[model samples]
Target chain A: MDKVENVRLVEMGQSNFIKPYRILFKQNKKDRIWDGIKVHDSVSVLIYNVTRKKIIVVKQFRPVVYVCNTTNNVQEGISIDTNKNPGTKGITYELCAGIIDKDKSDAEIVKDEILEECGYDVPIENIEKITKFKSSVGIAGCTQTLFYAEVTDDMKKTEGGGREEEGELIDVYEIPADECLKFAMDESYDKPVGMIFGLHWFHMYKLK
Target chain B: MDKVENVRLVEMGQSNFIKPYRILFKQNKKDRIWDGIKVHDSVSVLIYNVTRKKIIVVKQFRPVVYVCNTTNNVQEGISIDTNKNPGTKGITYELCAGIIDKDKSDAEIVKDEILEECGYDVPIENIEKITKFKSSVGIAGCTQTLFYAEVTDDMKKTEGGGREEEGELIDVYEIPADECLKFAMDESYDKPVGMIFGLHWFHMYKLK
Candidate 1:
């Protein structure tokens, strides 16, 4: 264990959109103090095609990756001219998910996320709450609930790539049930934990 | 899909200790500007006791819950006098984990987390990188690498519940291999996604 040291707390006002808090605490029997942040909880939905044995996912450009992957050659500060560089680090494959920042039941929020992100009209009753988990405990203490639902092709109401008004550029992709593990767990694939968890749950509890 | 409206970006300065960036993006082919934050990546480790057929986990208070659970009854603002309140909303059961903020390899960071968070002196070679995943997509685009390691009782060099010097109050708990799913997915249990992924992997590949 690292040697414990001084600890202090600095309070910052919350943002209208994002909530960022600076927390200071100690460790190793109160010998060291450490600082961290806490963010909002979220929801991840796994939509399965029962009739076809397939799972639906989405691919998008994450601004966080775009900012983190910035090179020294690229001058800091917002350079809207990123098209000149054509960066690809921001592209990611993830489960249909959203932050839990509304005044509705978890199931209701996930239902909306599914409709908005994946373009599926899944009835609220069809969605099953699998489990709730922290997105990351060490940094942000935000929790995420995992959900699963089986849908048929008939449930496809509109071309689902998220609402156009939010500036979301989503490409929906479906992989066969048997091939989900190989694709989701592929080391080269930019798969998130929620997607992997959703795949595992389908194979263990739904498929068999 | 909720109608996405005019979107815009408001660049915010980065912090020294914490990297909090304000990101604005569009959705659904619209020009609606939104605001969000970007955080650092992290790692989660699942330690298995091969001889005992049990999995190791840790419990701690979450600052997010401490802040979210506060209401009219609980006084707000940096009241460092929480010793009188003894709050309990942040307590959660999760896999041994840590943030990837250092200049070490993912394997090295996880190995260090195992030793510091769980008291297991595991060899780096014994740790297997299962996969990498995003902690949250809509909010924090931070990614986390999931690693699995099997340790024998002899590897426990010290009592691990997090370093006391950092003001960490952790309780170590172990669930039998056969009963992990029941406990981890028990809706009532405050289980995290990494633990569920670990148990499912153990059942799918290790056990059978």
Candidate 2:
């Protein structure tokens, strides 16, 4: 599913997603102006298909990760050649996640994300909260509430590939529990904290 | 140590930390441009004092977290009043961490952060590397390598309160292992995924 090409940086005005803000804080010794971005808090879920005995994961291309890997100079941008920085490098393994930009509750958004990204229609009653934490403490400081749930094959309604309209080319994967842990430990794979925490949580609480 | 006052947002031209960029990518179906930022990757360490039987945690004020709590508007910023949002609200419990800006190995940087932020003089041989993962996948996608180290009271080299010249007033706290887990679950405390993952890792591997 890696058909991405001609990745070039474009100078833009105020971003719809990341808004830079500098806040002045008077410290005890010296006054400091801290630079941070205002970003949306989000919800993520770690899913286990009980019938298949596999964990559900969504894989997608993250432009930010790609840019970070290819771009050496931060002040100025670079033209990312497909030969050098392939779309495969930008691909990241993540728990089914959605940013909190909608007006619905966090759990509702999680449900919507699962159905849209992974083709699973998980019942809201089956989801369990696994605690809330900020993934990026220094930059965004956005609270991401993590959840866990178990599903069956019957929960699958369609062949999900995320929302094509929003440029999401997600690939849904059903990996066995052990394989999932191995994948997380594999340094070759690009993964996020939610996935790491989810695997550890499942290992500690779910695995017998 | 919560004497922060007159927290107001200032409009700046370009950010020294976060530089926003829009990348145009040639997709399979429709051409889409993704917006992301160029940010710095960092290192964090979870420390356990073997002699004291306590887990060392650094607590400090995070401007981003504080601003997120105080501001309601995203486009136009709001003034953060101490009456409405206390400096304690901005405080986050983090592993001894530092952004990757110095010209050194990540492990060496971790050692410096431990000594500077938590005042622990850990032997380089004693420090062990945990798995690496991106905490903020959508936004920064910065890879943070987690490390684990065991120290003792005798290793306390100085009263670590972070770098005061940089306006960092960090407080180091050593909580019992069980209490650390309890604090992680407590919803009132602001924390990050590194702390959560580290706690679970300790609970699974270190705790007897």
Task: Tell me the tens digit of each residue's lDDT in model 1 across B1-208.
Answer: 1111111112223444444445443322323332334456788888888879888888776554444333212222353334433434556778888877799999999988888888889989989988887665555566688888999899988778777555566777788988877776775555667777887887777763
Candidate 1, what DockQ? 0.22
In terms of lDDT, model 1 sits at 0.66
Off by more than 4 A, model 1: A1-15, A22-41, A69-87, A100-103, A138-140, B1-17, B23-38, B69-86
Worst 10 residues of 1 chain B by lDDT: B1-10
Each prediction's total of clashing residue pairs, residues at least 3 apart in sequence or on different chains, is: 36, 0
lDDT of 1 by residue, A60-172 (tens): 77655444444322222454334433335556778888777799998898888888887888899998988777655544555688888878888887777786555567778
Encode model 2's per-residue lDDT on B102-149: one tens digit a residue.
Answer: 899988998899999899888888789988887577777778889898
Model 2 alpha-carbon miss at residue B196, Å: 0.3
Candidate 1 lDDT at A41 equals: 68
lDDT of 2 by residue, A45-90 (tens): 9999988889999988887887776766643356788887778888
How high is the lDDT of residue B64 in model 1? Answer: 48
